[model samples]
Target: MLQTMIMTIVAIPLVLGMAAALGRSRLPAPAFALLLPLFAAVVSIGIEGMPAFPPVRAAHKFPYVLAAGGFVFALVAWRMRVVAPALAAIGAAIAIGLPAWWMGANILAGNSVKATTVAILAVLAIVGAFVAAARKAETPDGAHLLPQAIFATSLASALVAITGGYMGMAMFNGGLAALAGGYLLVSYVSHIRGNAQALALGGVGAFAFAWVAFMGLVATALLAPKASMAGLIAVGLTLPAAPLAAIVANRLTHFPAALRPLINGLIAAVPALAGILIAGLQFAG
Candidate 1:
């Protein structure tokens, strides 16, 4: 466990430094976002060995596929511009639901009419939340929303992994958290200099991608019969917490603009802590 934790800790700064450099490169926003998952994959493989692929069976390989697909869909949505939300909804449903289906989740397999209905409704809910979060982050007033959301999701993912006994996944998520943290730090610096628009705009893709991919991960947890339900619920709560933080922070006329991201980070941390606590209990048991 100590070794695992050390590996996760070390991977974050490495990935963060690399991602920060990429963000500084002035690559098109969508292009930059598209590359995040690849970095995540490299980190995942570096720590966990190559994720089982192809004939290795979907059960073992789905994580890698889901992670990659989520980012790809975000790239597609960014390229679609005005149609991004609709496209993202479709992409998210497929990216998230398909993995559940592969995992033999009754909710996604359409085993019965009622099950199928519930599955569709659940997928729609996730899609709605995802699109809403992405759209909210895109707004000028909510510019910091996406980075905070990504941070929250990554944090929750790491917690979930610990509870679920997926040390590799924990490391992967820790790397993601570091990347998001680094991005947020860079973004805050840019904001201070009045040069944040480029990073913020480019972040739309990364944010959207992280949103969907994390949703898929949550679904993966929810479907696992032995997974910690408390942990999953905690993760779900963090999803909207991102946009909610933005909304609340926006209304705080008395708060300094420079400190808004700090406020956002605090808001995002609430659910993340809850998830860690619940998951830790399960781990302890």
Candidate 2:
């Protein structure tokens, strides 16, 4: 418990810092952001010993991970733009996914029904986050949808992993929280550079919703056994609420002047209603 608490504490602040930096800074946030993960990777390599670079090793399939991300930054530099989040995000996706595939596939393969389902969900979350980050990085003009999606999907996967009896739930959950918080902090950095108010609000909303998702997971764990099917249903519906929050944030907070309140309302309302009904079922059961 003490260790978990410490991790949570460290993760939250770090994530918040990263998120804040990403959103507001006119300077090279990606390069700055790269420092932390790069340092981490270096530390990991020191401890693990330098395995050949991914491209050189047969075991490492996503060899171009860094290259793809590096390319984005290079593109930006050539054009004389600030290093973008899209570059780091693309790099991060490759970094996380390749390792996860190599490591996680085995665990996922030897599972019972519930465990297998949870494993699939977790893998999807990891992959989805990668995709979302890449998408957001690639298209900065629009409201950043991918980061939020990544956060949401990651949260859901963590919840499912914890509730479904995965052994590494504590670490997974802690990581999810950190990643989500980081996404928000990064947006704050964007906000500092004169980003729209809605964008910042959207960042905050997504951050808050991530915690709410975490709480739902806790609730599911404690209450689920008593109302298995209903709890599952509640959790199932709640799983997508993060994406809805993102959509609403994007539409309401960051969309063009014309589409603001109307689309946001629709996006927010539907999931809320769905969550409410599902919660009712959990209670009823």
Candidate whose lDDT is highest = 1
* Per-residue lDDT of candidate 2, residues 1-285 (tens digit): 666455443454355436534543443433433332332222223222454654443222222322233344334334533323454344334433444345334433553433333333343334433333333333232344433433443344344444444424424334544555565555544445566442432222232232233332332332222323332333333333434455445534456543442343344334334434554454454
List the candidates' TM-scores in order.
0.74, 0.42
Deviation from native of the Cα of residue 145 in model 2, angstroms:
3.7
lDDT score at residue 167, model 1, on the 0-100 scale = 60
Error of model 2, residue 195, in angstroms? 3.2
- The lDDT of model 1 is 0.58
* Residue-level lDDT tens digits of model 1 in 132-245: 645734555455565666677777777677667666556666767776666766677777677645234333464444554374345436433344666656665665555566
lDDT values, one for every candidate: 0.58, 0.38
- In model 2, how large is the Cα lDDT of residue 116? 37
RMSD (CA, Å), each prediction = 4.6, 10.1
